[model samples]
Target chain A: MSSRDAILARIRAAVADAPEPPPVTRDYRTAHVDDDHAAVVDLLAENLADYRARVHRCTEAELPALLARLLTDHGSRSVAVPPGLPTAWLAAAEGAEQHLDDPEQPLTARQLDAIDSVVTGCRIAIAETGTLVLDAGPGQGRRALTLVPDHHVCVVGSADQVVASLPQAVPLLDATRPLTWISGPSATSDIELDRVEGVHGPRTLEVVLVG
Target chain B: MSGTYLGMPAFPQAAKAATRDTRLRANLRHATHTIRDKRARAVGELDDWAVLREAGKRIKDRTLRHLDTYLLQLEEHVTAAGGTVHWAADAAEANRIVADLVQATGETEVVKVKSMATQEIGLNEALAAEGITAYETDLAELIVQLGDDLPSHILVPAIHRNRGEIRDIFAEKMARWGRPAPEGLTDRPADLAEAARLHLREKFLRAKVGVSGANFMIAETGTLVVVESEGNGRMCLTLPETLISVVGIEKVLPTWQDLEVFLQLLPRSSTAERMNPYTTMWTGTSEGDGPRDFHLVLLDNGRTDTLADEVGRQVLRCIRCSACLNVCPVYERAGGHAYGSPYPGPIGAVLTPQLRGTTSAVDASLPFASSLCGACYEVCPVAIDIPEVLVHLREQVAGQPGHRAERAAMQAATWLFEHPAALAAAERAASATRALHPRRLPLGPAKAWTETRDLPQLPAESFRSWWQHHHTEPPTPPEPTS
Candidate 1:
């Protein structure tokens, strides 16, 4: 038999003796038992801050202005923009130079080091554990856009996108795609278990809690 | 078996030395207990934990079942997105693929994130053999590399060493690597971090190639994800002109939407935090943003073989959250090195055997390392039945054709029990000859058991015979005679 066939045969034998697996219930209640989306976003924002991610709150109208100002505050000169990023967001940064880069761009170390910030939309936000996920999609650029920049300003819509628990979020995802889950700025406490920020990914992450 | 954990002794012999080290045991116990307790509390905060766990398990299982289809879809998506995917059947193939990719760029050095998959494949060692230097940017990884020590835990590779050991390692070894520690580097956490930051920053700035392993791969979108507490992963991913990610095939999930579940489960289970500090992800590649060139080396190694076993395939469901490791009593005592692989603890016990095959002494002995305790099960975010797998592997060992003598002995015992009359006669004869019995079995297969335990002395007479002699007379007749 072919190797693949042989593998399948062995798997069959190994699992053949197993008691049949319990039936899977794909039917899940996803109506989100949580009462308020804004409340959940608030909790998530609060938790993100706890992990040292700079958190900002703004209305939809103020989002672009807030993002531009935040980028300026970080002294960002060239901001990486995902192709699907809200044009309005960049339009607000009228004076800030923009580098519309895709995730797969090949750039030199110094080149990436020069880029100041990246802006993207989030896939989902978990309130129970203040975390945000970016599936490289519209608005969210290639995963690198989030990683290469010193600062990341992610905008999360306060709506049904908020999930109270992972169980509620599982069925919503397909396993075969690339998924990036962000909880806070990349940091490690490896040196004497001393927490240090920005060894590889973004050193400073800013989340826009847009209501 | 190549350069990765080949010629490693059986788990028992390796654990023997580790268990004897009282200080090591103390450190391991303290670290494991603290992490495990904190993890328990963290998990306890979520009411829907069981549901989440079940979902995680099912999602992984389903994805594994249709892995080929998903992989094809992922490849299509990635290629369309301007990324290249390479399939590697084993470590040799993976190393060759990655080395060739790096060579194509005419680069001799590369930055690396903390990746277990890369370690499992012995990528750095392979690259070193190819005359390319790979810099470990993760702080713990740096310490492990500088000290020439094996990682002892999943989350904390250097948990066996304390602050002073780290300072000593940095003071002595930093210069040889490239950057030296600042003069009079103290054991203070801040000073140590600064030293590492200064040391790794140089590599990050100079390296033209980056290597990493993904936490997850989305098949639908052809995206690879790396979730780490350290930002070094991001640096290796983005700063380098070329990024090569060596990912295990089992890391694949179906779609981007599926990332949400794992994001919640991984952090709390691993670092005992509500969320991970950093998560880096990328598809094939994009122009004008990050690394313009991206290579995803999809590594199978022994995963497909492992996946064939239904009882063992559950290992693939593991998110590498390492909750099981933190709670493992065996791991707490013996530490990670005793497992003799990149993967350790309860997961390692079952997984290594399946992935590596139960052929070597280390692989064969791993099944017996565990106490069959189920604490790993309780704390596992995905609920892998580790003890059950260990026992199953033990049975597999006992049932192997090489154990002919043992099988025969068990068969003989079975036959004796099946023939009760013979069994009774044999028992009576043994009882009658009990005084002739030796304290220990001499020159026999049973000697090993007899050496540790004494045989019970026989009764003065067979109980059955005594009952027959004394109780045969009727009570009324006895009373009349009196």
Candidate 2:
């Protein structure tokens, strides 16, 4: 027999006399924050800032200037732009050159690393854990674009994209699509168990909450 | 320097040497205490932690009970999603399958995400024997690999090393692999992290094949989740042309929804984070995105044998959180290397013996390594009741033939306790010879027990005799009011 068949046979025989497991109890809190949307967004901002990600709140009209200023302030000469990103978002950023994520010709890791920053939109934001979920959907490029660059400026829509907890966020995501859940910039606690951010991923994560 | 665990001494012998190392004990104490306190605070943030933990435990149990069904379902979905699936009954088969896959890619080198299953089977060493280089990408794993040391802890494999030691390892040994450390490297955590990033970035970009182990495998969607703090997992999971994931059969979950419970349980329990920095989920091969060729190797080295026993089956539910390790007093002192396997601490004490069987001296000694403090049970996300399993394994070990002296001693004590007259006589005789007793036993296996502990001094008279002489009155019968 093949290993698959033999292994399955062993598992079947092992659990032949096993009793049925009890039903799962999912009585945990779905939302740790208040029901109010404003409060949930506020909690999201607070949690994001707590993890050392620079959190900013601005109106849709102020987003372009904010992006431009952020790019100029970080001294970024080139920025990675996802294919579906709103062209207006980078209208004010004249100093930094834009590199689009082309499907036919993908940017290599070395090329992405050479770029100064990456800007993308998120699918959803969880308030309880301060995580941003990117599904490689529209406005969000592939996982590598956001991972290889040093600085990441993620634009999140506060009114529609913010959820209060993991349970609330899970149902909103499509499991078939590739998902990247990032709470903060890349970090490591491997050295004497002390957390040091900026290893192998974006060193600085700037979350822009657009109202 | 050789990174090998072969021919290591049993637990007691190894632990004796570890306990004497003041530096190692201090390092372990500091690291475990820091993580333990933070874990408590993180878990405290959730008002319904117990409910979530119960849900997590039940989900794993249900999946394992119908594992055969889930395994088949997973294979079908993965194949449908354009990924190949292979099954390995033991370590040798799993190694051969991985070596062949790498050879097919025609790549002599592969970057790897940190994986316990691969380590459990000694995959890297196997690849080396086949003339392929496997680079460990996780920072902690890199430290272990560079220092030519066995991993001392899960979550943080080089937990026994301080920052200075890590700096030294990188500065002295990194050039042998690929990139050398920056000139005049310091022991700062940030500096060490920077050094690692520069050293490994080139490997991640140049490698054609990547090897990984998933935290969870969704059978319904055929998706694999890799939870990590650093982006090394991402680099290995995405940058390579071909990605191979070697996962244990027990890692499969029935649906994507099951991840909601474990994702909450694992991060807080292991790293004490609200959520780890990165959690990447993908279903098989994706065009123009990640790796084009994907392979899933389902490993069953000893899981089937462990699943066969009813009382011992709950161990299969472990999510490898490492929470039990931080909270264990014995693990805090004895350290992880003494366990003599990839796994360590409370989970290791129960798991290694079951996975490898109690035939070897090391495996047999693992059950007795713990103090049975029940702290491991309290903090276990799945509520494994490690103490109960330890006792069960101890019984199995005692039933084996090599412990003749111990068996005889236990039988003699049992006989004496069965006869009251004999027990009284023995107690009186022991008390009479109390003065002749030495503070330390000078001979045999009993001397090992007395090496660090004082033998209790005997009293002048037995309690039974004293009670007989002082209180001669008969006990009063109680009146029934009802």
Candidate 3:
């Protein structure tokens, strides 16, 4: 027999004496907190901040100005925006050049690395773990969009995009889509067990929660 | 399982020297205490911790009970999702498969994410033998690679290293690898991380083949998840053209939804964080994102044999969180190197002997390395009874040869206890020679054990004699409550 067959035979023999295991029990809570969007978003903000992601709040109408101020303050000369992002979001930031990614002719990793920052919207925001999920949706371009750049400004558009926990988020996510779960800027605790933020991924993570 | 731990001495001898190295003990103590306190706080935040831990244990148990079925399902799903699947019965086969894959791509180098499965198989050394150099991308892994060292801890592979030592490694060796460290790299963690970023970026951007191991593989969807703190995992998972993941077959989960329990348990248990900085999930190859060519190597290096033993199979439930290591007193003092395997601490003690078999002297000694303290089980998210497994493996080891002296001693005692006359005579002879008894045994199988404490003083008379003199029938039974 091939190694595959031999191994399967071994596994079968291993558990032959044992009875069938019972169906798994999932008595754990689906959501640690009540289903209040505002409260969940608050928790997300706290958690993102806890991991050293700079948290910013802005209204939908004021998003353009806020984006401009953030980019200008960081002294960013160029920003990479994913394909299909709202053009109006970067309307106020005319001083900085925009490298709009065309899905047909996508920017290379080398080019993405040269850009100063990236701005995109997320598929879901997990409140419990303070995670932002990107699925290469219309606003989120691809895996490389948020990864190569030094900074990321993720916009959690509304409460509909917020979930209380991973259990609530997992069902809605499509497994076929490439998923990137960002909790904070890149960080490492490898050096003597002391956590220092900003390694290879975006050093500065600015999550703009727009209500 | 790797050349790194080849021909290692048994646990007693290895730990004997390790305990004397005060610097190693101090490093292990500091790193373990920091993570232990943080893990407690992180776990304390969840009100349903016990239920969550139980759910994790049950899911793993259910998956293991039907492992053959789940593994077949996983292969079918992966193949359907534009991914190729391969099977290896052992480490040497797995390495040959990977080396052939890398050579097929016509690449001389491959970047890697930190993985225990790969370490167990000794992938880098195998690849080097094939004229391929694999670069380790994680910060701790990079430190280990640069220092020409073996991984000491699971999550923090270079926990034995301090910043000063790392600074020196980078300063001395960075140029030899690729980019030299910047002038005057200090001992600050931020600076060290920055130096590593600069050094590894060139390799990550240019690599054509990437190797990894997944924390969880969802059988239903064929999606594999890599949980990590640094973005090295992201770069390796995304940047390369061809991605090969060598995962142990036991890593499979029955469904996509099963991830909820582990996703909640793993982060807090491993790094004591609510969530690690990056978690990348992909189902096979994507049309325009990540790697275009993906291969999944399902490795069964001793996992099948481990599952055969009823008492020893709970070890497959481990998620490689390293929480058991942080809480183990033996691990904290003796350090990870003494375990003589990629896996260290409580998990290693139970796991190495099963995976490698206890025929070797070092492997046989692993079952006795523990003090039977149950801290590892208490902090274990999946609720594996590590101490119970240790004792069970100890029984198996004692039953083997080379323990004839201990077996003979036990047999003599059993015979003496069965014969009342012989026992009485023995006790009287012991009382008669009380003055000649040494405080500590000079030499014997128990010399090591007896050297730590004094033997009890033999009484002039036996307990039976005292009872006879005091006219003690059995003591009167206490009155029962009405």
Candidate 4:
């Protein structure tokens, strides 16, 4: 028999005497934050900053100026623009060369590595854990778009795209689509258990919460 | 559990030497205490922590019992999503599969994410034998691989090394691997981390094969989850052209929604973070993103055997969080190396013996390494009664051929207790001879148990005699005042 068959047979014989496990009792709260959207977004911002991620709150009309200033401040000459991103998001940031991602001709890993910053809209922002979930949806080009680059300027819609907890976020995401749940800029605690931010992923994560 | 751990001394011998190394003890003490306090504070933030833990435990139990069904489902979904699936009955088979896959890609070098499953199987060594060099990218894993050291802790394999030691290792050994450390490398954590970033960035950009282990696998959708703080995981999972994940079958969750419970339980119980920096979830392969070629190897080295034991099967409920290890008094002192497996501490005590079996000296000695303080059980998110399993394993070990003396003593005591007259006479005789009792046992076999602890002092009189003397007649009941 094949290894798969053999393994399944072993599992069957082992669990023969075991009873079926009862359905899990998921009494845990689905949402930890209050229902107020503004408060939830505030919690999200607080958590994002707590993890050492730079937080920028701006109105829709002010997002372009904020993105432009952030790029200039970071000395980024080139920025990766994922497909379907609002053109207005980077209209004001004309100084930086924009490389728009084409799914038909996606940039190679080396090419992506050379880019200085990536600006994209996230599918949702989680408050409880201070996480951003990018599913390669419209504006979120691909898993590697936000990765590989040194800086990430994510635009999260505070009005509709913020969640209070993991339970609230998981159901909203499509498992079939690749998902990247980023809580902060890359970090490591492997040395004396001290957290040192910035590693292989984007070293700087600047989240712009726009209403 | 793998070749690297072959011929390891039993827990008692290894732990004996570890305790003598004051430096090792200090490192373990500092690392474990810091994480333990942080974990408690993180878990305290959620009022429904108990419920979340309960849900996590149940999800794993349910998944394990119906693992075959879910495995079939996962295979179908993965195949449908443009990925290939392989099955391995043991570590050797798993290693062979991975080696063959990497060779088929015609790549001599591969990058690795820190995975307990791969560590348990010793994948890097196995690949080396096949003329392949696997690069470990996680900062802690890189430290262990560079120093030619076995991982001592699960979450932070280099937990035994302080900042100064890690800095020295990197400065001395990094050049031989790829890029050399910076000229003026210091012991500062931020500096060390930055040095690693510059060193590994070159490998990530040019790598063609990336091997990893998943934190959780969603059976319904065939999505694999890798929870990590560093972006090494992202680099490995995304940058490579051929991505291979060698995951233990037990890591599979029944449904995607089941992720909610474990996602909450793991981060809080582990590194004590509200959430890790990155949690990458991928199902099979995306058309233009990640690796176009994806492979999932489901490993069942001794998990099936572990599942056969009703009392010990709960060890499978572990999410590799390392919370039990952080809270364990024995782990705090004995250190992780003494466990003699990739897994260490309270979970290792029960898990190693079951997965590897009690045939080896180290495996047999593992069950007796704990003090049964129940601290591991109290902090276990999955509610594994580690102390209970330890005693159960001790019973099994005692039934082995070498423990005839202990079994004989237990049988004699059992008989003496069954006969009331004989028991009373024996107790009185022991009380009378209490003055002659030695503070420590002279028997060599029992000395290990008594060395760290003092044998209890026998009372002057047995409780039976005291009860007779104090209550010869039943005391009259007091009248009700009302």
lDDT score at residue A71, model 2, on the 0-100 scale: 97
In model 1, which runs have C-alpha deviations exceeding 4 angstroms? A1-33, A56-126, A132-181, A189-211, B1-4, B401-482
True contacts kept of 1: 0.42
Task: Give per-residue lDDT, candidate 3, residue A9.
Answer: 96
The RMSD (Cα, Å) of candidate 4 is: 2.6
DockQ of predictions, in order shown:
0.28, 0.85, 0.82, 0.84
Q: State the TM-score of the second chain for every model.
A: 0.85, 0.93, 0.89, 0.91
Worst 10 residues of 1 chain A by lDDT: A24-33
Q: Which candidate, 1 or 3, has the higher TM-score?
A: 3
**Per-residue C-alpha lDDT of model 4 across residues A162-191, encoded as one tens digit per residue:** 988899899999989999999999999898
* Descending-DockQ candidate ranking: 2, 4, 3, 1
Candidate 3 C-alpha lDDT tens digits along A100-130: 8887888888898899999999999999999
Q: List the candidate 2 regions with Cα displacement exceeding 4 Å.
A: B419-440, B450-482
Better of 3 and 4 by lDDT: 3
Better of 1 and 2 by lDDT: 2
Off by over 4 Å in 4: B1-3, B408-443, B450-482
lDDT of 4: 0.91
Docking class of 3: high
Top-scoring candidate (TM-score): 2
Candidate closer to the true structure by TM-score (higher is better), 2 or 4: 2
